[model samples]
Target: MSSVSVNIASKVQLVLRVALILVIFGWILDIPGYFGKYYYTEQLLALVAGLAATITLTDPRWGRTPARATISLVLGLTVFIAFGYVSVRYPSLQLELASAPPGAVALGLLMVLGILEAARRQTGIFLPLLLLALVLFSMFIGPKLPDGFQTRELSFSRLSVYLALDTNALFSKILDIAAITVAPFIVFGFLLNAFGGSAVFSDLAAKLVGKYTGGPAKVSVVGSAAFGMVSGSAVANVVAVGSVSIPMMARAGYARHVAAAIEAVASTGGQLVPPIMGASAFLMAELLEMPYRDVALAAILPSLLFYAALMLAVDFEARRLKIGGTSDRLELPAQNSDAPDKHRWRYLIPVGILIYLLFFANRTAGSAGLWSAISIIAVHLIGPPAQIWHRLQDVWKGLLQSAAAISDIIILASAAGLIIGVLNLTGIAFQITLQMLAISGGDVGIMLLLTAGLSILLGLGMPTVGVYVLLATLAAPALIELGIQPIAAHMYVLYFGMVSMITPPIAIASFAAATVAAVSPWRTSFASLKVGAGVYLVPVAFVTQPELLLDGTLLETATALTRTLMGIGLLTLAAIGHMSRPIPLPVRIIAGLLAVANVLPVSALPQLGMAAVAACSLAILAWAAVPARTTPSLKHENT
Candidate 1:
């Protein structure tokens, strides 16, 4: 609280911020061949800077007092020195380090503890605990297990070398992908919003869908989808778009919980869409060893189906509530379509460049992202001369913000790298696969359900990135072993992981949106589950048909896609129980059964037969209900 202490804290904060910027910039440019010589240096530098910032950011009650600042500096310096020594000394002394020199082992232990503390700081107890448990299991329990389950016993020196000195543990593939590919995209996403990209896209989305029945909700769906492409985090999506849409929906006469749920589900769906997909799409591509474009292409239809189902549910909700676009009932946000034409068109340039580079130029994802980030800066600088200086300031600030955002992910990915390292070292993934097979009796359906349940559970408390990583390594291999398409299996886990953002008990997205809408988090989360019912079904659909992932013939894909859409339509209606009037319970039940049959991975008997049954059941309900309900004219006059 003293002046000298305050100034010291301020200086430390500034230093950490600068370090963060340099770390991100270094990775993006791989400055002066550092990555080529010592890849771990670049990765470790980012990790260290992220941990430093997190310490400062989460400082004590005094808020970065001298004591806290001193602690942070010491911890950060120690990590930097440890990682620096390991990276610089290891290549030349590979054999010596492998022999368990006191210096190397001690440094490795420090790095491990630092990583564990960083994970605890960023994501809470679940992941760090899981990581520690894995490490303990690998070190102590593995050798005692039955012959089929036991891994080769590792000495302390050997485990330390693998975890800290080699590429197999802490510096594994997932971390490599995260640093080389995902971090750059995270920077690009932050850069887009720092420029005029967000406003431009919001205006464009409003213009495109702001006049529909549930105009504001639909706008949230559209805007969040686009924003999610860049942000790739459901929490970020909710904060960015829901800040505008949640209030707008409430003002348009939606219940507060309904408004919050709508925004929550829509933002969560952003991770399902491509080009950004909250970073999962890129990770999936890397894991599958496929081109990024192929991953995006396969994701296109399922993402569409996700939003299509959302749009319909929103529209039906609007009709059920009789919400409309009258001034008092609902109106477009004022910012939409109000920007000058010249400024608005600039938004498309970066997105167009990104698409061209990703699909046509066939650039590495990191390169594509770096170029896009540069293009965004370029467009901002080239804006109207009067705004250039101000825009330049915004870009500078954006660079710092992007660095801060990238740092957290670097920390997470590195910590997760530890879990992956242990899993590989102890052969735990194989053991898990075998256990899954045993529990499911080799039934693919049972395995899928169990995976879905496990994904949802992990997702409730973990970051989507971590959840996906765990599932991909442990659970997804089981699906692949059962003859599922590789992409289908991966996408299956990815979708369920994202759905956790809107699920009950701990729906992070719903909690965020509910705060914006002033609704109960519990109520909003349950409502999100209801509104996002299709999130649960779509993954199963793709897994069953594979055609939804474009893995089948054109005719077959089209036919399957059509039936699925019809099924989703009826499902939405049944879930909402509104079509002119609320549907009776009996009709709702029939509609539910019909929806399942239509989307079920079965032959013509259930698919066509259920479609016919649902149609008849709906007709009878409509005929009986319509006469008793108020006519449109009467309802309008009454309003």
Candidate 2:
């Protein structure tokens, strides 16, 4: 492309991004309602999808070569035309029933292909490849499969039209959640960070734990958790928090890979934290048809246990490696150099208002996010006059970044809708459920394990929202059918889906952190797995004993919480191979086994047996905390 064309494309891209943000914010704030010209959900979704696709294709980053640029521009234009046609004709198309017009059908095919390509450009090839495989199977191979797996075959045109135009396919509830509920929060997080909220979180975390052993790693955990409250992406969290924390940890005596792993695990757990979790949590509330607050409330104990386990593992590892606390006190970075004490309130007040709006005032998540974003702006405006222009520039950058981030999510959600549509159209969802049941042989444990594995597998190289959508569609049903509670089954998949961020063979988040730490990605990934081991088992505990999700009476909930925390602490000890002193391999094995036994469902054994198991686990833990007789222990190790 020539310089003139490049300038034109850049201008167009800017316009598209601004328009995308305005459209989403308009819908969120009901500006259309005020104007007496409300857009139907499908029409609005089509518009958003069109804008996202066009933006993705015209992005300079994706157009590295002339040929690729030409191809992307052509596809971008084609998608714009198709989505515009659908947006204008959606109402009439809805009335067409089984027969779509030839133009709609042709455009639908174009739209589907364009979306898949856009997704490939934005994310990676795995998701698009999987969606393509499913499309081909639905179109050709469905009826040829074995009796248990077969479904009525769909034609190419019919399938394409349905996926592109149907309410449940490309423009589904998942897309709605992404555009309306998630986009605002993404913007809120970006704005919060841009206005020094990240600095506030880091400074607060450092103050709280920087003098202790493994202080930098602990800061990563606390800061990431605070940042995760508003962030929806683990990789984003890693980049934002780990950029500061990783180097801090390395300076504080942690190995580069260990520092990266700590940041990766800490960042990934942010999605599991409450107030505001990942995009999937919003989708979960919608899927389960419960209030978002209820979902957050239920997530409390499990998220806490996850962080507790991570903190314990960090402490144990610090002791084992003989890493000590920083001698000098930590200070806020340069961007937040002005009156660092006051910077803390910039984040605290907005977050407090967000919590109040969500939990106390009964506001929708999107509304809470909008108000929180406004509060962030208000806080920044109140800062020193000389810095206002710089901060506003940061806010503008955040707006564009949020739009870009949201576009990626929009693509993923649309692709997910395509998958869900294929399943529903081919009647394969029921077949898969039956196949899972048959494979499990009516065993709930086996079914849970199968689901967990599949969740992790599908999650590789995918975002949490995309991972959860796949599992929720393909696996959660089977677990629910196996008599698991609806919330438990959904939360189970959500938890396992998150583990992939730290799991090897992909571990996208870990790899991102490794880049910052200048370490081997593989080493960082495996170390992250060790630090975040609790994530793998906590889901099981919640699934088996719902009290961990706060679904039981007070006593039952307390008992489950206490037992699971103990189990997590013991599991961390085993994984780290240290306590007061280095534990022998046999003792580590025993601790691991006892951790599992402690977290087993109360109903799995009689009351007396459960009590005995808990007692034994506690006794063993107490014994492990004592200093070894043969080896001299550092005083810090005994803390």
Candidate 3:
């Protein structure tokens, strides 16, 4: 390609990125509605799709080879034309769906193809292949399959039109949630980070815990949790916090794999934290038709249990390896030394406004996010005049970054919407649900195991939002049918889906951290499994004890909380093979069993389980208090 052409492509890409952001902001502010007109959801979706297609094709991250660039440019332009036609004709096409014109059907096919290609570029072949298989099955392959697995057939044009233009498919509620609800939050996160809120979070976490044993690891936990409130991405959280914390841990005598694992596990839990969780949480709120606050509130206990267990695990691992505190803490790269104390209010005020609006003022999540972003800008404007130009540049960069991030999410959501459309149109989701129930013999425990396995399996190599959408469609209904609370059921699948980021063979977050820590990815993954064990078990706890989700009576909630906490504490100790010193194998086994018994809802002998848990807790405490016969050399202990 000529330099002129390349420069033109880049400029076009920039324009598309800016336009995408403006369109979303326009929707949020009801700019069109204020002008005595409104965007049809389909039209808005078409525009987003068109802009995303162009921006992604021009994005150098995917590839920049001349041949690839030429192909992408041609394909992108074709998609732009197709989407443009659809956006203009969608209102009339809706009325003609049963007998759509040949031109519309051809354009619909182009639109679907373009979206699948964009999805492939962003997420890899797995999701796009899955979507293609579903489409092929719905159109041609289903009638040949065996009973129960087979789907109803549709013509190619009809299927193409439905997938591309129907509100349920490419332009779905899932996409709506992504575009309107999740995008603003993404903008808020980017802007906050740009304005140094992330540094504030990390510094605060360090000041609070960096003097303790395994302080860097603990700092990772607290810092990741605080940053996770806004990031809501496992890999993003790891990259942002782990870049600093992982090296800090290594310098403090932690193994590379251990440091990577700590960072990975801590970051993955961000998806489960309240206020602004992963994009899937907003989908959950919409799917359940519940307030977003309810979802956040229900998530509080499980998230706390997860982090608490993680905190203990790291502390015990540090003791076992005899790693000492870093009294002279590692200097954070992003920390501002000039006015660290003065800028604290800037971070706090926007976050305070966000929380107040979401929980107390009863505002929409989108509105809350917009107000929060506005507050951050307002705060930045009031800062030192010398920094104003630099901060304004940061805001612009954040807007572009947010547009790129949201484009990928929009593509994934569109693909997920196709999956949902196929299931609903062909009745496969119902059949699969029934088959799952039959395979489990109608037992809730068996059903949960099946669901968890499937959720993890489906989640491999997929982002959390995509994983949650797939499981929510395929696995959640079966769990819900087994007499579980709806929120608990959804939360169960979400946890397992999110955990796949740290599970072996495809632990994306852990592997990313390993790259930074220069350790074996496999070792980091297994270590993460050990460190984040509670995340695996806590979902089952919540499913069985609705009290964990704040859905039960006060007494029931307290009792469940106590048992679950003890269970998590015991489990952490067993996994680490230490209390104050190395636990004997037999004692570890006993503690593990007691942990299981306590965590599981033993409805028939609930009191017995509590008694056993209490006994185990007392025994562990007593053992820890007893002095070691010979103090081991702390400096020489092997990692």
Candidate 4:
């Protein structure tokens, strides 16, 4: 594989590198686009970028496998031509779309096959093949499908053309979002990586937290979470900080799986951490047409609460297993070594400008991201590096990474379009929700539980934007039908969907960590479940009590935040079986129950009713931890 990578670096990667650069360069607007149409060129370039980068990233000897390269190249061409050919000629495209001409149908079917193949290569065959099966099922057996799943006989000819040309299907606005909006953030992340941001965060974490009990593990959590919020991709986050933190934890006497799980859970949690909780948040802001700041602020408390629970879990487990702190002999990397510390101060400029643009300047996220990218290049070129030539190369590299990142997301966007098509075609979204409500007997608990479960499962297999789009279009409507607030409903789905990266079956973050640590993927994912327990609960709390989401009066919101943080503490203690000392099983149960109770939506009086249980549980745990005279003397003598 390493030899293959070497081969790829020298050969087949050039075409993709050029495509990404061209696509990113086109964003600047000065370049005359392809054959008089820049839009076609851009879209084509974006498509080419995905294929080229995927090939380059995976196959070291990118061109060595002629079969893989040929297939990828062919698929790339199909997607570019299919979408570009139609979108540019949107009218004739619509005609083809409306009537489903055989030529167009043949084209669309071929395009779908290409996308499936491309997706299979990027993330493996599961998602692409599964989604393809669903598409096929919709086409063949749909009319004859059983109840709850039946649809009219899909006209293969018409459907193909419709799906191909209609913006609502394969080449939809979601794809546009991927191109215009999501691409820039990906660029920002690439630039951050090209510089020293990931390493900076990790070292900063270790400098800050690497000396306490279980310090390396804690640093892994803190650093990964901090970087995850910035990177937005679980796989990237794990690969970035886990490269440093995972090994650190293993060296600190933590088992490989446990260490990997810590990094994976924390890194995955970063997707939910605010002010920019994943790229999906940007999409949410656009979907709701809300200010990005408001969305970031809305995500603030929930992110903190989730991290609080994780931190507490790490702490308790550290105590339970007597995991020691970082050894003083551990070495620290120089903050700015080969990179030179001269521009160290200038590093703050781009980040500062980005923050200002988002919070005070009131720019659209797309505009803010564009300016931020510009600032990064500008500052590095003028202020610090002085090596204009080297920084230029950095810019080119960042552009390629940015473009390569687009492929997975574009497929997700296209898949989302198909998902939307399915829902609109069958009106199944509402029906499914109605059925869920009916199954739950209209009880909020059952309703929320089911909705959240679906969100997580969907989230596990999908990207942030895809997951939210799927759930928002499906489960959210039912919650709204039950009178949930719109923002609350969206946030509920968003949170669960984001956490899915760490959830089992398709836990991207865990798998990513396993790759870095050389651990069993399943063990890493399952262990992540322990640290990420609050991910399962936080979404429920926010939905049930919007106050926890800061939707009400300051006093109420403050109170809710406090209670929720406390609940996180209690839950963490219970889950890790440690509170000052090992908690007895019954007491652990009691604390957990109280924690769960505290999170439930309750009227004012009902809230107070649960206080007794919490207060009593705390008292009993404290009492139990009080060492008896005889036992205390024997324990001291033994020590």
TM-score, one value per model: 0.90, 0.95, 0.95, 0.88
Tens-digit per-residue lDDT, 1-639, candidate 1: 446655655565556666655665576686847645445453454354344435334333234456665665567557766766655565464677658777778777788777777667777788878977877887789889988888667777777766775666676676667766777777778877666466666766777878867787887788888888778888877877776777788888789899889888888888777776777787789999999999999999999999988888887788888876522222222222333556756867988898999999999988898888888778767745787667777777777666666667766777777788878777888898889988999888899899988988988768888889889999999999999989999999988988887887888889998888777999999898778775577888898889989888999899778767766767777788775577788877777776666666756466567567557645643553463545579768899
Colliding residue pairs in candidate 1: 232-278
Q: Which residue segments of model 4 deviate by more than 4 Å?
A: 1-17, 20-64, 140-142, 145-150, 324-337, 341-343, 382-386, 604-607, 617-639
lDDT of 4 by residue, 303-323 (tens): 888777788778767776778
- Name the candidate, 1 or 4, with the larger lDDT value: 1
RMSD of each: 3.8, 3.1, 3.1, 3.9
Give the range where candidate 1 is weakest over 10 consecutive residues by summed lDDT. 327-336
- The global C-alpha lDDT for each of the candidates, from Candidate 1 onward, is 0.75, 0.83, 0.82, 0.69
Identify the superior model by TM-score, candidate 3 or candidate 4.
3
lDDT of 2 by residue, 229-306 (tens): 777688888887777788888887888898899989888889988988889999999999999999999899889988
How do the candidates rank by TM-score, highest first? 2, 3, 1, 4
How accurate locally is residue 336 in candidate 2, as Cα lDDT from 0 to 100? 38
RMSD of 1: 3.8
Candidate scoring better on lDDT of 1 and 2: 2
Candidate 2 vs candidate 3, lDDT winner: 2
Model 3 worst lDDT run, 10 consecutive residues: 328-337
Residue 492 of model 3: what lDDT? 91
Winner by lDDT: 2
Residue 482's lDDT within candidate 1 is 91
